[model samples]
Structures are given as C-alpha cells and as structure tokens.
Target: MISSDAYILGKIKEGDGNAFSLLMEKYYSVLFKYGLHITKDTDLIDDCVQDVFISLWQIRHKADSIQFIRQYLLTALKRRIIRVETQRKKTLDLHDYEFDLQFSIEDILAERQVAEDNASRLRHILDQLTSRQKEVIYLVYYLQLDHAQVAEIMHISRQSVYNLLSETIRKMKDFWENAR
Candidate 1:
C-alpha cells in the first residue's frame, strides 16, 4: 500500500513520533542526494538535513498546513544548506552562493541512442547553461517535480521556473540544429 503524505502529516501534527520517523525514513536519502547537487560535502549535507528535520519536529503543529511534504522538505533543506554554507564562508554577500547543479543528463541521452558526437555536443551546450537554467532542467526533468513544486524548492516564481526551462530547451534545440 502506498503511504499518503497527507496522512503522515496529520499524524505528525498530532505529535506522533512514529509518523515523524516514517517521514524521515522516506525523505532522508532523497534529500541527501538532492543536497549533493548543491554542494559536494556529504558530511555537511547530512548535518544540514538533520538540522532541518529537527526544526520540523520542533514545529510539528504546523505540519498539517504543509501542502506537499517533499516540496516542503526540499525547500527547507535547500535554504538550510545554503545558509550554513554562507555563514561558514563568513561573507555577508549571498550573491555568490549558487546551487551549481552538479547533475548531468548524459546517461539518459545515451539510453536514447543519441549519437556519441551529438551527446558530446549536448554536454557542451549543457555546460554553457547558467546555474539556474541547469537547476530548472534538473528539477523539472530529472526530479520530475511540477512547476509549482520546483518553484517552491527553488525559491522562485512559478513563471520563472517555466521561463528558465523554456530557455534551456531552446538552447538545447539551437545547439542540436546547428550541429546537424
């Protein structure tokens, strides 16, 4: 039987520790993997995730208000990790903190039987994309999150997510066409 996040959330709001445990079990690996795309420090990511969950547990009363558990956890982790990294650097300038999505779609392209040269060209194009463009593609295509969920996790407007994804697709198409 599939577990419903809403049901789990309801239990969490009622202060059920077991329900909170289930939520942690379900999301720990996913959030850890997502964290790797932002920063390569596994130790730091693990600590940051623990902190996020601890904070959530402390505010369990608001659990019932969460719309999407995955989206909520993802956004929380993203902010926590970024803030921790920023504070560690001791530079008040958050402008330099970029997610720098460390993911690639090359394996999927290979499965599609795209020509080796084409895949190489695509990688080149992907490398040229801005960090936000790359993140939008990863969030939408790899993670399979909808625009609203992606926007929430990314801390951007839903329309901005759509626009970034559109722009990335256009760039890929342009490269593919020119390479043909």
Candidate 2:
C-alpha cells in the first residue's frame, strides 16, 4: 500500500527527517514548475521552492493537518514567489506572469507520424490562450485538481474557478470547430 501525504506529514511533525525528505522529493518538481509559471526568474523560483520546504520543516509541529499536499505546497510556493517579487517592487497582478508549460502528444504516441499533425495543431491552439486561461487549464486538467483546490491555489473563489474553466472549454471548442 502507498503511504499518503498526510501520513508523511504526520511523521515529519514527529521529527522524522526521512519523512521530511520524502515530502520534499515528492513536491519539489511540481512546486518548481508552478513557481516558474508565476516568475520568469529560475533562481527566484528555485529559491522560493527551497524556502517553502524549509519553512514547512520549521513549522511542522504547529502546522495543521493537510488533506491535499499538492494544493498546500502550490499555495505556499505561490505566496513565497509573490512575497519575494513584491519586495523587489515587481508588478503583482497574477495575470501579468507567463506560463511555460509544454504539451507534446509524441510522448504518449508510439507512432510519431500518426499524431504529429494533430499535436502540432493542438499546440498552436493552446498557445493562443491567454496566460490566465492556460494557468487555469494546467492546474485543473494537467494537474488533475478539483475546482476547490485550484481556487485555493489561485486565490480565487470556487465560482471563479468554474467560470474560468467554462470559458476556457468554450473557447477551445470554438477554436477547434473553426479549425475543422
């Protein structure tokens, strides 16, 4: 049986260093990618991820039970990135950032020629979406997170999450239909 994040967190609270290491390894890449979407600076993103983990270790005993570790780490990473950028007098609008997520169907396809054209077209359509729309899609679809989790991570209401997702899907459908 796989151990849950909540269980690992409990062990960390008990001063288990191995549990802390496991937590860091599990979330580091996901958190780093999320931070990259918020800030273009690689060093800044890396630093913020490290800071989040360090802070988590320091506050393990006082931290409340975390039902969703990915959401929790993402929220922390976003906050850390924002706080750091704010201190440097950078613009604070969430939509002001760029998203660099890459989607490739070739990785999933055994025969490259079979899906090459479709993948290219899909990539082009995805590139047409606004940064906010892409971010919402990435979190909700690629990350497989629910509306509530995405809302908390994005600092938006649940209704906003639904609205954004709806609009994104509608736009994609329209684009795809027109393309066909």
Candidate 2: residue 75 Cα off by (Å): 0.8
Instruction: Choose the strongest candidate by lDDT.
Output: 1
Residues 1-180 of candidate 1 have per-residue lDDT tens digits of 434998998899999999999999999998998888888899999999999899999999999898888989988888877878888677644334456665466677767777888778888777788888877777788778899999888878999998988988888779667655
TM-score of each: 0.84, 0.80
> Which parts of model 1 are misplaced by more than 4 Å?
1-3, 88-96, 102-113, 174-180
Report RMSD (Å) for each prediction in the order shown. Answer: 2.9, 3.5
Q: Would you list the clashing residue pairs of candidate 1? A: none
**How good is model 2 by TM-score?**
0.80
The Cα error of candidate 2 at residue 47, in Å, is: 1.1
